[model samples]
Target: MLYQLRNAGFTLVELIIVIVLLSIMSIATFSYLGFGAQIFSDVVGRDQLISQSRFAVERLTRELRNSLPGSARVINNNRCLELLPIHASSSYLELPQPGQTNADFVAVPPDNYSQGVNYEGTYLFVYANSEQRIYNSTTQRKVISGVTEQDSTLIFDYNTTPTLFPLQSPAQRYFISTGPVSWCLEATGEIAGQQQLVRITGYPLANSPDLAHGDAQRAVMASDLYNNIEGGQLPFFTIAATLQRANLVEIDLRFARRQGAEPFIIHHEVHIPNVP
Candidate 1:
């Protein structure tokens, strides 16, 4: 019996069979490990994209909500938004008219006016290529820029007839000019081939005929302003804006994630006030 066992152990064919089985197992294990690493990397990349998108949206929403309505004007042939805030006497101001570099303007206090008057306004300038900027009315210095471009829109001009107020009640207050403003922006490159789109709409301010209000205020009121003016089945993210008060605006942003093996989306809403 001992001799038979020794012969069985010494068989070269049996040893070769065991070696082949072990090799196959090692290959299979390595392959599985490699696959797992790939999946983990993909997941991390997707998460980073989602986080960046969310952060960009949130920052934009905040800036929009604080935008000043009266000071908001279209620039670059109605491709950008230039905003100026109200200013108090004794403050330094700058105005950027078409074809003009920062023209300086000083605020003079109304004669015989009492003190403690709030004389300041928020200024904003929005443009394509995912650029949103804020400026100080007094210093004429840039406050912020490059908020986020991952997904954004440039709203040009909008149409709406001025709302008429009762003659005996009060003067008609204008919020945002009503009408359709051409909105444009580039979607993410990764999803560019997938036909991604962004939908934008404006909400009329309460009792005001103007279209958008303060960025933050409008954002709050713009929650339900999406009407889908353009018809299509493309994957879309929605943005809405409305004027809440004379010096306040609100903005709403929603990132609609596409289904399938795609990155998740981040949604945001913010209110801004005192923007010119």
Candidate 2:
């Protein structure tokens, strides 16, 4: 009687093939996503390591540069560096007599040196016959009004001969300059039991290396301060004497995410202008 309409559907074989292809594609997509996630994790970790380490190194550099002439010391045995950071500076326009605030000194700080040390206040030991500090808590500036002794500047005591200032007694040793200062670095358990570069800062006795270690003012400047470093390579800092004092500083910093991760090494030889 009539040409009946017939519905056409996918055959069983074709349906099976389509399912197999879809399964394969899904598996591939998931695999790709997982791989991408791992890559992202590694990238993030490395970046984080870099940022933390770089900050520490920059801080160290700043402190080293800001250190009073010839105050940076690297204790080889402890793998630590010590420095007396300058609070502020003004040129010694003319040696001012006692009780003179308006002397010819017009705060001639070095390049990038802060101007606050003189007026703003610091724990600076004025060079009278003996070191003296006139500190005003409110102003946070050392008042040098009554201090006698023409050379009230902090720079004093040069190591005329070879000296080995060890970490055990940093304050007792003769520093390049005698004033408030402290030390740190290559310390263990500073960051997650991992070796880290630390910055130790504080006001210690002028010539008492023994009392120099007050407390670790700053810690973990750069965690993982090592990256397979070895041989003529200082993993952190080294202070070598030129002439009679520690004038040349060599810093070797190695950054890495993990034990076997790629290393980022930064090495610098800094010759301090202030070091006498």
Candidate 3:
């Protein structure tokens, strides 16, 4: 009976073998779990980048599609587009009168406040780091200092008079032109260690209120157009406009993603149906 009971129990060598097998299995399982965790983290990061890019594109597109003619103006020598709301109480449309040598505009008060100039509506004149800002009118404020000295190109395209006139010229000739005007802007510089290109389109809204304060004015119509392009690809985007006798305008926009990052793009377009 004693021999039978001893035989039934596991041998010391058998127990040792079982313990070694369990340890090996545990190590392999932990290694696999670690690998799986890393993969999951990578996938989540990629998804987040994609979602952010999509949201940006959708917002930009909606704004551009609603652009109106004669509602857009270029300030700071065409560095930025001054956009006005379609229907507003204030006289929001103001551009430097053509033919005037001065590069800035004078802020007409009572009808407009010089202090609220930046907020009442002004386009940010951003080049590299310098920002030359203005009011609803092209009135110049203190030049934005601390602009970084970087190699970059800013381009502006406008369908104005054939003659390249000076700023501060007569309003009739520069402000209320007989035809539509289109302006295109592009900037190039290093952002975050990568070379990038930024482009924008300006569409002027026709029937915009004159600088006169007595009459409620509609804001200028314009769009962001394009912002930052990398990797030699032109980024996918679209622009379209319609010109009637009352309205004149143009639109430009695009989408792009940074290099070595997940692919993403943002698009914007502005259209003003009634400008004449």
Candidate 4:
């Protein structure tokens, strides 16, 4: 048992080998984790973009659907989509058309009508066939001067003295609107190299869409749009109604995280089912 006592520890060569192995393992583990984290980050970014696009599209579609018939029009060279949202609609029992002295009409009260609800400043539209009649002609649009409920029917008086309407709805349907609403895609004034989608409200109804009106209320609906207008690409396209098809609104939006990020494009088609 008289053997020389050896050091009860690893040799220098053994320790060096163990250290090298640990270094390799650590490098590989961190690399894998870093790659997974990058993937997660990318997925999250994409999801957020999708959610924003979905909400904007859905809200725009809802308003278009509830708009007055034949009231959807694209102006500013397809940069803006203008619509007159209907507050209420009803079937009329009598309408004061052209050459009528009395500018009063009787209609069945709308389902949403409530007591003491003022109808002043609300416009009455009947048989609006084209964009011209809806926005340009005064006869086709009349402001409600008074509203009175009597025996389950409502009487609506017009501000116009004679109420010379150019056309009448064959279905006898009347649409009420407060004013025009517009969705416009424009360059962001504050943020450089980015575009913004904005909604214009309270602007005086005009024959053309006003991108900048001093009295209009503007709100940004979405940001980070990358639409290429100079390259013949527009955010909105209006397919006119034909005998074989109804009117269609094509919405093409391209979004990105930033200016140089990958673009996420969304295409939506909204059909106008309500015709004049």
Top lDDT model: 4
Q: Which stretches of candidate 4 lie over 4 Å from their true place?
A: 1-31, 189-193
* Per-residue C-alpha lDDT of model 3 across residues 26-74, encoded as one tens digit per residue: 9999999999998898787666655544554454344433333334454
TM accuracy, model 4? 0.84
lDDT assessment of candidate 2: 0.48
Off by over 4 Å in 1: 1-12, 70-184, 187-260, 274-276
What TM-score would candidate 3 get against the native?
A: 0.35
Model 3 is weakest, by summed lDDT over 10 consecutive residues, at: 125-134
Better of 1 and 4 by TM-score: 4
Q: How do the predictions measure up, each by TM-score?
A: 0.38, 0.56, 0.35, 0.84
Q: Is candidate 2 or candidate 3 better by TM-score?
A: 2
Give the Å shift of residue 253 in candidate 1. Answer: 7.2
Tens digits of per-residue lDDT, candidate 4, 11-99, equal: 89999999999999999999999999999998998888788888889999999878886778888877789989989988988887667
Tens digits of per-residue lDDT, candidate 1, 143-258, equal 12121111121111211111111111012111212222212232334642232223233432221223333431221211111122234222123232334533322222233334
After best superposition, candidate 3 residue 37: deviation in angstroms?
Answer: 3.4
Q: Could you give candidate 2's per-residue lDDT for residues 1-276 as a string of tens digits?
A: 899899989999999999999999999999999999999999998888878866766776777676665456555344666666665444333333345554432222334443232322233222211111111121111223322223333321212111211111112111122244433445464444246765555554333344335552554566665533334445545454455554567777766666535878777676665322
In model 2, how many backbone clashes occur? 16
On the 0 to 100 scale, the lDDT of residue 70 in model 1 is 35
**Against the true structure, what is every candidate's RMSD?**
15.3, 10.1, 15.2, 3.3
The alpha-carbon lDDT assigned to residue 276 of candidate 2 equals 24
lDDT of each: 0.32, 0.48, 0.34, 0.83
